[model samples]
Target: MKREEFEKIVEETIESLPEEIKQKLDNVVFIVQDYPDSDELKKTKASKYNLLGLYTGIPLSKRGTSYGMYPATPDRIFIFKANIERICRNEKELKTKIREVVLHEIGHYLGMSEEEVRKALGE
Candidate 1:
């Protein structure tokens, strides 16, 4: 899929989140890359094909009183377009996967573990 179209799907997926969840998101940036970098690919321990998205940065539940006092950076969620597209055959499937990946990352930001994220997203 084209980058613009993929990004639009991502935005739609984000907007589709429950309002309570959406409201809790702060200092987070969502971006898309063609594929996972070598370091990330190693960290995930999955062959590149199986890696879809990643949430990098401190989770909200881990923050303290002085969390934002200085040069701390916002969290980042990366969606791998090539990997995602490889598993999706059509636009509908693409959108669904995008939603799942995005929600999964948001779950992490909200302090959910991998299992919890999958459970919460019911995927």
Candidate 2:
């Protein structure tokens, strides 16, 4: 999918989230990039076809009383349009996979483990 379309999906997904989860996203920014930088891809340890999205910043689990003393820089969730497109054969598959990827990355921001996300999604 194109960058514009991918970004739109990210926006739509955020808007469609449950109120509780949406409320927690107030400080995060959603960004769509063609692909991650080399270092980012390495950190994610993703296969050439594996990485579809990423979350970068202090996760909720890492925040504490000391964190409150510092000014917050917004957390970022980056969706890789090219990576997502590479694995999806059509619009329906793209949308579904994008939603899952986006949600999974945001779950990281909320301090969810992979197991937690899988259970939450009933995957």
Candidate 3:
């Protein structure tokens, strides 16, 4: 798929989220990249070929009272476009995979552990 189409799908996926989830996404930015960067791969310890998405920054649950006292960078959720496309054979599968990866990363943003996120997604 074209980069523009892929990004549109990502935006739609997030918009399709339940209102409860959408409301909690304050101070979060969604980014789409062709591949994971070296630093991101090292930080997550994930192979570039397999890492579909990643969430970075302090999770909401971990924030203390002083959390916003100073200017803070927004949390980021990265969607690795090329990696996602590589594992899918068609657009339908591509869309599904995008949703799954997005939700998984959002789970992390909401303070769920990897295991918790997996269990929640029935993976």
Candidate 4:
């Protein structure tokens, strides 16, 4: 798919989220990338195909009392366009996978464990 179409699908996925989750996402910035950078791959220990999205920041549950005292930046959730496309055979599957990735990353942002995230997504 074109970059524009990929970004649109991502935006649509975020917009489709529930109001409660949207409110909680106020401090996050979603980043779209063609593929995972070396740093991301190393941190995750995941190869290109396994890494779909990643949440990087101090999760909400682990924030200290001085969480925002300094010039702390907002958390980032990276969505990998290429990896997602590689696993999907069509736009329909891509869109569905995008939603899954979004939800999974948001669960991480909310300090959920992998098991918790999968359970929440009914996976």
**Best prediction by lDDT:** 3
Error of 4 at 36 (Å): 0.8
1-123 per-residue lDDT for model 4 (tens digits): 888888888899889888987887747888999888888887797887779999999898898888778878899999998889899998899999998998899999999999999999999
Residues 1-123, candidate 2: write the lDDT tens digits. Answer: 567877888889989999998988746898888788886777777764567788888887788768757778988888888888888899999999889988898899999988998788777
Off by over 4 Å in 4: none
The predictions' CA RMSDs to the true structure, in order, are 1.3, 1.7, 0.9, 1.3
- What are the Cα lDDT values of the candidates? 0.88, 0.83, 0.93, 0.89
Pairs that collide, model 2? none
Global CA lDDT of candidate 3, please?
0.93
Residues 31-108, model 1: lDDT tens digits: 899888887776676777788999888999998999889878889899999999999998889888988898888889
What TM-score quantifies how close candidate 4 is to the native fold? 0.92
Instruction: Tell me the lDDT of model 3 at 101.
Output: 94
For candidate 3, write residues 1-123 as lDDT tens digits: 999999999999899999999998978999999899998887787898899999999998898899889999999999999999999999999999999999999999999999999999998
Of 2 and 3, the candidate ranking higher by lDDT: 3
Q: Weakest 10 consecutive residues, lDDT, candidate 4?
A: 20-29
Error of 3 at 105 (Å): 0.2
C-alpha TM-scores of all predictions: 0.92, 0.88, 0.96, 0.92
